[model samples]
Target: MQETRDAFVFRGGAMAAKPEIGSHDIEIRDCDVKYYTKRGFRFRDGCYDIQVINCTADAGGKEWYVEAFPMSFNVIGGAKGTNVYDHDITFIDCIASNNWHINGDSYWNGDGFCAEGTAYNLTYIRCESYGNTDGGWDDKSANPLLIGCIAKDNKKNYRFWSGAPGALLWNCVSAEPNKRGGNSDYVGLWTKGKIRIHNSSFVDSSKPLALNDWRVTPEQIANMNISVNNSLIELPEGKELPAPNYTVSNTVIRPLNETGLSANGVGYKKDMREAQILLTEVRPHQPRIEKEGRLLETKPLNVFSEKNPSGWYLSDWNNAKMKIAKGKGINDSNALEVSTNGSKGGGATYRTKRDSATIKFANFQKSDWALKMSIRTGSTNLSGLELRALTMAEAPKTKEVPLPGTLNGSITGWQEISIPLAKLKASASEANFANFAGFYIRANGSMAGPLYIDNVRLEPMN
Candidate 1:
């Protein structure tokens, strides 16, 4: 394939003058595509045995699926919010790098591989994307299979938008997420489908798996059979990220070094080379992974009344400046603000004043519940906000279990931080906090300064 600039002569404008091809196999092998308006190459009406092999695309703009754009493959097309598909397409050993450019007000720029509007049964073997504006692969479809792919230095890496079902990621790597990205590189939002990721590595993303609590449900994800198995991830280097969020099922996390995955592939671990084969061969002690339990409902967290009886009162944080701006809450309009200036030894604790020793719990299992709080920081600095969960005792004791990620985010707008009730058990005795005084927060060691918190409530895990 000789190098060419703007080699894309095929164009799809309103589907009026699209070229009609034969019904036989269409193959574009070992070619270089450059600069086009809508897409580099497209096959709108679909064909039999479509193969894109050893191709490299650059300078293509506006929804350019350098490899494939299923459903509406022939153009920069498809109605937004429509579920459509194009099928039986395969891309092998291709590279879609720097295929980013802006042409018009309506046009957007850059994507390594993109699928939209119900596209299905597409396969990419050993493909990669780099320096794109959007991400490595932005998908919104069903039954797409990817094997041995790589992504680097894009706004976001693997973005799984709303899709039908059946998405697979195998032996892929997403690294070096652009600092300006709000979510991490491996962003997963669509949860109503069956998604499986195995023997892959997600490197240098702070929050690799961020599915919004309001948008997705555990039952929805579990019912869809979404599982992340034997994957490795590393936090952003030298940065104090809270921790990676793991809200999926059947996830077994291992380190890169432990897998013996050196740069040379010297170790040749069984997990990577024979992953698909080993999945079929399980031992006796192994448990067959399946769907999680039934989902729960969510509601407003109505607490802290004027006449406190359940011992719910505001935290009198020591050496901290605080305020209560009425009518600024999340659902309402009142929010609490706190700035830590003189916190010592474990920082300052902003906990509720207690009187009664215990409060009652619902009949749901502990893991079925979560304490949700809506908080946002004024600056990109305030971090280290810990929600305190205490057990009712002579001196209410805190359990020693690992908590969820701390409130270390710096989002400039309101975002919810959910602590799964399973994580609130500081010790084995508090496993089921039936004898609970109540909850509060430890606001100290303000990394970036003052932060605002509101809409503190206990709701079912959604």
Candidate 2:
């Protein structure tokens, strides 16, 4: 297949021209696509009941090409808040390989098979993905099933970040990951949702398995219930699997010792190659403050009323500084003193922790909930100061509101800032803080000196 860019497109909903009937109930059989500039076979949102049988996709993007693109076979879903999605897809005996890209950074793309967004119920049977720059199977669907599939010599073999009911892998194999410059092969399976692995094999990975917790709710994490049954998990010599938070039953763990051939007649270790994927050093475990059973109280949430900055942090900290001290706030109270080097992305943030529940305001009849804070700036202008409300979705839906009434230089002492929730609701109609992750007081390189903030809290309008 050859095209100007992004070849072989199949889109559903308004993306399709003319009648705009979404691409659905389609079958692609015995097709071979190769040497495409981007996306050998693309399936967009609203596509459903699609089948690809006995197909092959290779060399999606040229090597060393400076561009950011997804997999050769991409199934991307719709935007958040839109109910549209791609669903009920099936792939049998398909192969994707040698897809790559280069963006000068240590990270780029060329994933072999990527299914993202809210796409649901995708099944891959007897598929083989190998020699890709990025993940062999980068999935974020609500529910995906993989049976008898093999992923080899890719940067990351499998990444599962699904939603409710999670994903399943049965009789699958991930082996012989590409190791560049003597670094350990990346994680064999990186998961973030409820996952059940049965009769699978993970071999020769630097890290056999790793878990993620980004944008995932506490309830979801509690219900993740990761179970690996009757699986062979192997890591390189001298590497130890981290003590898992989930259950690992009937799974074998051992040092990487051997290699073998796949059902496709390709040696699992023969095509050891390098490609651009997110290169992340194994992260240290971040301990969360256990709330036990303490539920969040949004009506009178004391975000920063404490005498110390326990949960507050500075954003863009590479060129920023945060100081928590008393006698530096309104009425000589405890306050957060944030100083930045006029960097582009300096800000103060209060990120919610695992114990914090979603801040919901939809049940209230009155829309008088407000984010209250006391601020005193030592900068030339508060022009670029903003209050950004963040969400818990993977691609978060945020609301950014500028601080009203610009001050020329500095405030005399303290000024009370009361931002109405109704205004935030009007700005982002779909955001009611049900998925409220946290808040950010952004500086945006507009501050001349330090910004002092105190008594940040959320409550109804007085």
Candidate 3:
């Protein structure tokens, strides 16, 4: 049956329930109900299969209440108690706004719309509500779906309790009131229930969206699956986010003071100690104690020392052979030689033009190892070194394998370079120096000055 209730006014004393409306579908459309001193529509006794379409309820200064007085006496407006003890309700394109509840001499409790007790399959579609003393829509029941609803400028947009499930919120926007002192409460959508938010934007509200608070635990969050994709969550600038733990596949994190190595795996402590030793000791050649009883520190090994053919393996080349142009301390020195075309500079610029050279090592083999070196290009010009394995043939042509770019800084200091064994293998796929083969280092391009290189070592992984 279609019912058109226009300009219907109700005040106090729950609306009398219609008698014996058995198995009949009721539709209330295009109705204007106002001045409900108690609840605009109290569906207590028993009302089922009811649909409210395009209907509005405006409580004109009536004191709205949830239960009764003494226990809870205030101007609690909006719909209280369903038409029946239990009913399946659906509100489509409806609006419930501007309701107030009075207490004693002052206005205390108020709400736009409030639903409690037992309710089932209640759906609100495209419903808009705003400007209420309390929340815009408060649902304490279960299985409620609010879709495409706009609840803005209300004290609280939507405040729901726990034990409520199947609450679906889609395409909903809740904003702050347009006036001052509106008391923007906690959140735009605050609920303790499991809610699914899809294609929704919650912005410019007092507080955007907040999930379960103290009542919820970490285990509950872990068990819950919240899939947020293609959604824009814009927070105010400088807003601090709460710490939330997340889990991913093939990833493990260790605590600050805990050992980083697995019990069944090789630890990093051993590798670190070996690195320290390599940094101090020059491989293949032992350090020589000078006449002054001071053990002289050996200069870093150069994988590409073919440019200095005569001084490549000389013991006192620092004091002989290559002329030191800018000698810093007892150990640091910059050696240079003028090019035939007058390209003489103190950096790698004046170095030899040999694109490749071979260095004979005592014993070498194909092994998983790490190469660490330091290169200081004192000039801004591009300079690099290459390492190539030499085959056991007469006058083997050295294959050029380019190294990383020079560090961007004053070459007065040293920058450590580390190349993993796997990386080296990937770079030189064709060359296989399994047993004993000499390696080469060549200087190429913009050789207007000398290049400073030191601290070269190849160590096997533990």
Candidate 4:
């Protein structure tokens, strides 16, 4: 490699090895990588605490892997022994543009900044990626976080499909949709699974926000949690939404008409062009990276609240009586208590609130998550207790799994229970659990006393 004109010319960039022999805590900064074969820069093999700053990757990718496509700045992590993933990787003030592998595939190839193979805790700050073949920022990390990043002129500006403890982006920019040179631009921000976008801007994009799923079925898209807050979405004429059926709060929508301006003479296209000019300069404008503790960290999905028990209600059957009792839960909070008086079977359900037609819940596709709950039993004979994830089909189905047998008889105080998500049993003939509409706790056979359940949650596997 030669350092000419303050740019490092290299064929490619990557780090790969076995898990125990992998590199860590490395930093590569102020380099320009261009005209490469295969990939530009890739971080693999469980590398953690790495940083790439003030770098530019351009005109790379002649041949690349289909599983992990070539990108300007990339990170690929796969299952080595037990989910080997690159963690705590950060890209700061980097630019990825004009990267392509056109002859490889139609759409599922090449990107600007890509993180595949289930990497975790990747943060991109003040980065701008544009004009790539596929996505500008196609990140599939466990908890990929982007702040003050701008993406423009790519097929998809930002494609995020992470799983539980999902993705978070704030103060980002997506502009100039369908302006790619090699591939046709598709949408602005394509996402699947849980995502939260705050104080972002989507300007002049035809389809600003769309699902990143191939199976664009309504039932499947309904299971996603895409929350956008305090953003500005300015679209062209005949376009309506930055996101459809998502939770958007305090967002301003400006539609460009024949005059190329909003009603109040707000020229969004001019603003985007000016933004492009400013971004083309060295050290583009970025927000102050405040002490927002661990931007890539994710929290467990708590299922219950102190008030109303988070919409959990009792449904009794076969002469069984059940109700939610307040101030009786763990730590004197609300809990779901089901008591039977010579009854056969009954349980409780937590029906998720629907946004339009979508049922916002977890999708069991990407990461390994476990169901955790605290159970306190006052009964003697508790048998055949099942937990089910209710689907969102026309004829809805359930994927049910039996609880632990430790809660059977003579079970005293609160016992913490953890069940892997893979334990959810279903027949091959049964429908897949695409989008979970709710959760169900069903009891078969006879019950003697009250069953107490509190602090239910779905947490990522360690």
Best by TM-score: 2
* Clashing residue pair totals per candidate (backbone < 3 A): 16, 0, 24, 0
Candidate 4 local distance difference test against the native: 0.63
Predicted model with the maximum lDDT: 2
Sort every candidate by TM-score, greatest first: 2, 4, 1, 3
Q: lDDT tens string, model 4, 1-462? A: 221211331211112222333457678888777765446676664567778888887754333223334567777763232234566777878998866655433444568888874477777777898777688988887777777788988878898886556677666888776643443447888877777776677777668887656657887677677777677777666765445557877776777422332233221222223322443441222222211111222347666555433234446566455567888898899887766555466666665543112222222224555668888875465777878765455433446787774776666788888876555635545533334345677777566667777887767686
Comparison by TM-score, 2 against 4, better one: 2
User: Which has the higher TM-score value, candidate number 1 or candidate number 3?
Assistant: 1
User: What ranking of all candidate models by lDDT puts the best one first?
Assistant: 2, 4, 1, 3
Tens digit of per-residue lDDT, candidate 2, span 160-249: 886446677766788777733222246677777767776678876666677776676776556555667667777566765443555676
Clashing pairs in 2: none
TM-score of each: 0.43, 0.53, 0.40, 0.50
For model 1, how big is the CA root-mean-square deviation?
A: 22.6
Model 3 residue 218 lDDT? 78
- RMSD vs true structure, all candidates: 22.6, 13.5, 35.7, 18.8
Candidate 3 has a TM-score of 0.40
User: What does candidate 4 score in Cα RMSD to the true structure?
Assistant: 18.8
Model 2 alpha-carbon drift over 4 Å, by segment:
14-21, 60-66, 179-185, 213-225, 236-244, 259-462
**Residue 350 C-alpha lDDT in model 3:** 17
